[model samples]
Target: MHPLPAILIDGLRATLFRHPRVSATTVGAGMFVAVVVVYLFASILLEMAGTSPPWMLLPGGVLTVLGDSMLTLIAAWLLAVLAARREAVWGIATVLLAATVAAAVVVHWPLGELASYLVLHEHAGLAILVELVARCWWFFVLLVFAHWLAPRGLGHALGSAVLAYAVSAAAWWWLPQSPLVRTMPVVQATAEPTSGDQDGDAKTATEQDEADDDDAPGAKSEFDAEAAMYAQPALLDAALARLKPQTPGKVDLYVVAFAGDAQQDVFRNEAEYVETLFAQRFGAAGRTVVLENNAATVTTRPLASWTNLQRTLATIARTMDPAEDVLLLYFTTHGSDDHQLLVDLDPLPLNQIGPDDIADALKTTPAMRWKVIVVNACYSGGFVDALRDDSTMVMTSARADRTSFGCGADSDITYFGKAFLAEALNRTTSLREAFDLARTSVDAWETADQKDAKPDAKGVAGVEPIQHSEPQIATSASIEAKLAAWRRTLHESAAVPFAPAGEAMSRGASPSPDASTRSGKG
Candidate 1:
């Protein structure tokens, strides 16, 4: 085995636990040397991860580490003075140094690097949570070792443990960051080069290639992300401005369509198609705004972030009368087990919207007294409990514990999205009637697919049925009447056609127009 790993393993076996194996013997110079070495190694791990947009070593970082070392030594000295009458001072110091060395090698190795990997993905919040848990473990280790080093039979070990936590606190605040390193600020000077700056573009491209090779994955495409983020404010403002004012005395229906999870184009396709459906069939022309998290729409349509959703909802509320206007929010995304709508556009820290976010956004406006929220994602029925109210109609793609299908790289729309928006809503504006139709269609489609599904390559099982995704709906009596009234105002129109996003709109461009007016297009 390599000497470095061999030594690390030895340290872990001896001093990594609550009761360290090392004796309260003399504090050797070599023990202190080992402590310093392990600390420097841990610092290297933190600083290296920090620098990949990644953190870089700040000036005086070593000074902070040195100060931490000094605190541990000073703490040991104080405990020795109070307990051992200076007789076992070196022994106490030895135990502290041994504990420090073992803790560093263990806690910051697999654990520290894991946290840093999340940081590379722009998930610093998760890293901080990890660091907090690490801090707690660090304190526990210190407390146990302090009990071993304190004077025997004196019962002063508890106080010694408390003092040991001071050392832990000093280590905690400065460990991940330290006098050490900080994340690099994103710069806005990375826009694409103009025709006149071709030579500059070439140079920049070469520089980017070097950076890509040298730094971690987090470093690459950072500039592109910065430019994209810099352009969002304008894109969001434009989307908000496009919302037309409410027609007088009519129960105006405004739509906010959100497409999350940029990895799959199915979500974006479903959102865009629904936008066309509501505008052409439902007479909500000029009263809809789309927010999608797609690589293509980053600069055109506002990214579907919780903050953007709130802003869009607030603007829509103000545009229409609070007493009678109805808002329809369509969400198409991949859901997690815990029911969070995945709001992801890589290298951009977009906030994930959970069930509670819906109610919070509505409360802020308090304008859309009537609403129909359709969530077309797996496990989306979990949102019904959080969002359902007397004046609101909530519909979900699947039960809280079930999974919905038809959303993937090859899919143009999810099963629930197609049935609810592309089929049901296209045929009838009554949300209640549409949900019933879509539900039946979804159940039949799922049942037929399960029967036709082939077995695994091993072919161990015969044809059997799969569990169904029981779609859920929460209807409001008041909202139903308002929707019925609004439907009366909608112009006579043909059922909107069902076309995949790719067929309906070209990538990186908005849909040309509502082509659903033609008869029998559905």
Candidate 2:
């Protein structure tokens, strides 16, 4: 063979037979197969339901296959982007996936329903295949896209796609069914009444009479009156007595209470107590911005939104030195695994305000010399983990595995809030001291009551306590002085310099001492 032809052949072999490229192509092909399987299975289910016309089903199948292919492609693109550390591409792919899923769910409701029913019927062969396809197709798509787009060529794409597929499959298999699915209605046959039911009816009537007695006016009045007494101003006063310092305005305080939902009344009672405590000790006059029973306001608006509470904090920060010693944050609400401080709205993703995100936000805010964030909620300790910073002190009502407790149509203030307010009102204890005491007491209560329900009570007990993790009150003076000096330097450096003669005039420079001296002489 000629030398040039032999060289060309060798180069072609090296390029075409590369492991990475072959792997990527293989993964992409696999994803295509998976998607085709899902579509066919879904189509068969729809046909069985008699809802799909043969001709219409064909087009539906095509669209489903096409949609799945796009999803796979997008997934492959994402995998590749992630592998290459291409943030923009990854973000775009994520958003695209979310949008596509949302749209497909809306557009193919009937198809999903049919597929769901088929799976529910426990058709092992069809269900297993469909699930496998649904789970694996996205990985292949991502691999193919990555291979096409990634700078490292096919190998990187293939590796990433395979990894993503494994992860998706594992998650799909392990994840619990959605709440809706778990609560699905089971059909049952109705039974006819018999003559023997008369005895049962007589007993029911007697039970109803007893229930009415339990709900009589006197009994209801006594319960309501006692609840009102517990929620009275005196209880708040006691709470403040515990939380208050000897000097007023010595510490800046922020209280965020999320009530409403089905648990408004309970929360309302707690809110009232907390407010009263602050009022008595801190002089409720200007210290508090109570978000009274407003779960919607807290959850719906982003933290950056111009909520009344946010506005108040901004004003306070503006008025005080950025480095002033101040206790900055207090939050009481429901929390979820996703790290969302859930209130009235559905749980938000924890990623939205992860500990790192909270740290970043606090770093920029100039108002507080020291930041103290207290979260009273189920799984609230997770917030502490996310919000911890050199400048922050964190406290949570419960650990990540536990639930905060209280009952009253979900309206009563939670046990965590109640304990917290009680300690705060004492006035002798500092914020740090109060949080420690609260955590200890709450944990003890949860442990004692829920010992048998260990898993269920995982988060009920607050754990991993840290006292004065950031700048404590003792070091506040020195930190404040240093901050002041830095601020002065910043201001001095930022001052515009004076220029001379025509140069100064043209540039609109302010007059300097030297210029004034020369002008006076002239």
Candidate 3:
């Protein structure tokens, strides 16, 4: 062999075997460098494809990386202590730095793929288990390393691994808090006006919506004043008084657009579309009522608030025949980790709605026999445990621990809303069927989005699986039968055509005189 080749082979052998003359520091530094090189290469490759690195989170991505590195160092130190190793602090630090970089590189691709898979499927528990395996792979390596360095007994390795995991998990849960402020990319509106009746009644509704948009400029300045009026007790009472049930029907949907500050436009638009869709399909003209919180795109509408919601339910309950009619309530808003639905409208802070609040409202409405509730927000699955009963069917956008996606100022609807309301409902009349289709669509979209945004080479890193947002549904045993019956009656009514509910087309003008009168009688 050539002299240069022989020298390189000897050097590698010494480094791998931890030769007496070669300090642990030198070996650790080399490993650390190797990890950094891998991470940088992955980042560069991703960037070249017009994709941002997985660490580009809001508030401070650099800080998050630093936090991860710190956890690695702590774990390494714990392992050293458990193994009775007296390695230099600097050598240990270098080893940890290498471990952190290696872990980041090792974890990304799998995480992204798992996230994509989660979006397509409903097996969140399994996905999370796999993710834990990926995340803790470094610890597994560290265990073997502890034995290699110190030749300690199996007990030492196991103890070190257990302690390292406990400490690292605690630190991860508590540290690395990031603020929620991110720049939203603008997306052009893709939804078009819906098609309607032969007499052009649908055209009238579409034109009215367009007219409302055209009138936005004048209404912008008056938003504050109008918002204040909505806040007043007297104005709210008057609006509530004006609300009467329309003709008796098997089903009624009461929409509450819980406007939170995070993405006012997205929440508002989705809520409006859902109300219109439900009204048109389930005999909404007189039977459906919407209480909005934000000025949204249509400034002419009134803002809905917590107080307004309670009152609306009360009024609806008084007018509705509890035993014969069904109530479908849709809540669209932002959510917090504490499982509270955030209600916002700057200059006027509102209370967050918890599962208790929803339960209380329902309890007050003793007359509404059957209930179908849809919660569109992050951490909304927390509501299912409290709201689901023998007569109620509760559906949520995400699990209690996960955050749902697509609630941005530039977007029109959330992932859940788009899948369930806008798309699935258009294709099916059954709520159960709509939910199934929507969930599947959401999963495909999420998986595809991650794949398109982040393509990997040699599968080093995949897209960041920042959110799981596992949607959930809990239907009461007998509620399905009732819902089926309601659907039958709903379609038999001839008030509205089986048009795609809430398509961009005209929804027509206000409620007709006949609808209003029937509402009054109820």
Candidate 4:
């Protein structure tokens, strides 16, 4: 063996055999060093990938890594302290032997699966299991060592492990929110498109197409919407045919329902309800589109894949007088830690949507100057950082590290969607006001849930302390003025009646004049 390797092995052996008292200071230093090294390596790999945005490379990225390192060190130090306490009662040899056995057990643990579950936030039962283990696995290892060192029975070891795990988890939960991970404000002066910029005659072409569609020889008498909502060129042409020229200064509304399979029914329900609400409020019955993947009979058009979504958005952008229209896009789905919003309707493959996907699409449609984007999913706050711009307002259900609740199949709406879209929008005319009210409602709901949470052997039942979703909102300065103008228009329009008590909107309704109606095309 090389001299350095031999020396390192000898040192380890000596430390094990001598059973030296491991001071808290020594353990703290070692853990801190290890954590820093691990995070440093991770940051290097991130840089090498060239995938991180510019913001991440500087203060944001650096801060995130530091926060992560601190979290890791905190967990490690807690375990070390427990191990030391046990060693004091027995001897170092027992602690070392126990650590070896614990290492073996940990090696057999399903860590990879747990990590996947955390990112995807699917399979609720599995999520609970993963959360339980992830939060306390370190304590479990330390407990094994403690048990051996102190000659404690398994029951005593379990109790001590739980207690230690709880304290450490509480500490982590109480840590101040990291400044590294924060919302970036959009600089309106630089980001907004100039008025004099003219791209092409696309707007004129769309107007002509809409005028021609009003005299169609034949059109579908009613919408026979199907499961696959992909845009065939012919279908798209037909759909765009009936759009009329947009009225000057009209704030037309367009909705996109991005659904994932995890909470299919809930997503579909919210999409349908919002479509109805907007149709009535904006006189935009034909403008809204529901692209969903539930196994339902034919209420919603099927969004076959990511291509369909992109095509639909492009069509809407092209058909509408983007300069005068306001697009209200509602995306409800699961979210990944990698900043992807999940889009699925199983067996058929669907591409996941990332923050860049949305930003890129918006960039392509500079004519649609005003946007209200609501992302109803876990970890959605990550989207705000990427999607924020002078003409857009972004609201997300939860911060990047949190998961929103009430997305199960049995639920009617996600906590954010219900509060922001269904209830607040109806009660208040202002989008920003709705957002404020929705955020407060969500916070109260989460607080109540957390208060009732009780951890068991598996995890908390009916509630989770760490699963509280912290909703986020980001708006550009320019959008605030635009939104205020839109609010006035909304209030002036003939308002839709609230849904009758104990009932939401009907599941199905007859189709509208044309998809371009929101743009006043036909």
TM-score of 3: 0.50
Task: Assess candidate 1 and give its TM-score to the true structure.
Answer: 0.55
Candidate 1: worst 10 consecutive residues by lDDT? 513-522
User: Mind giving the per-residue lDDT tens digits that candidate 1 earns over 1-522?
Assistant: 543344444345434544544444544556565656676667666445433333445565676666566666677677766565476555455455445556655564445556645543445467667756665665555555556555364356667766656654544443422225433322222334322111121112123223222222212222367877777778877777778898888888899899976766778888888788888888888899888877766666788886678678877866886556788999988665456676766767765667766665664322356788998876788899888877789999888877677875567778888888888987787889989999999999988876676777788544345557789999866678778899899888888877766567543436533111000000
Q: Which stretches of candidate 2 lie over 4 Å from their true place?
A: 1-263, 295-309, 345-367, 407-411, 451-522
What are the models' TM-scores? Answer: 0.55, 0.35, 0.50, 0.50
> Worst lDDT window (10 residues) for model 2?
513-522
Judging by lDDT, tell me the better candidate of 2 and 4.
4
Model 1 ranges off by over 4 Å: 1-223, 462-465, 506-522
User: 420 in model 2: Cα distance from truth in Å?
Assistant: 1.9
**Per-residue lDDT of 1-522 in model 4, one digit per residue for the tens?**
542233223223322332223432323243334434443444444333323333332354455445544443344444445555522322222223223222222421234345433433324345445545544444554465445434557876566556544543344443422222212212112122112111110112122123223222211123323323433333444444444445566766677666654224566667666767777765556776665545441232445234556556666766775655777888876565455665544334455667866764553222356688988876688899887766778989888766677764346677788788777877777888888999999889877766676777777464324445778889877778766776666645544443421245353454433322000000
Better of 1 and 3 by lDDT: 1
Candidates' RMSD to native: 19.4, 24.5, 21.0, 25.8
How does candidate 2 fare on TM-score?
0.35
- Predicted candidate 2 versus true structure: per-residue lDDT over 1-522, tens digit per residue: 542233223222222322122222222243334434444444445333432121122243355345443543455455655665444443323322332232233333333344444533434345345434444444444454445456577777677756655443333333221110001111112223222121111111123123223332212222233333234233323222233222333433444333322123344445444544554454432444443322222321122111223334443443443343344455554444434443321122111123333333342222244455666654456666556544555667656544456522322446666556655336332455565566566666655554453342556533322211121111234334433432242211121222212243466522211100000000
For model 4 the TM-score comes to 0.50
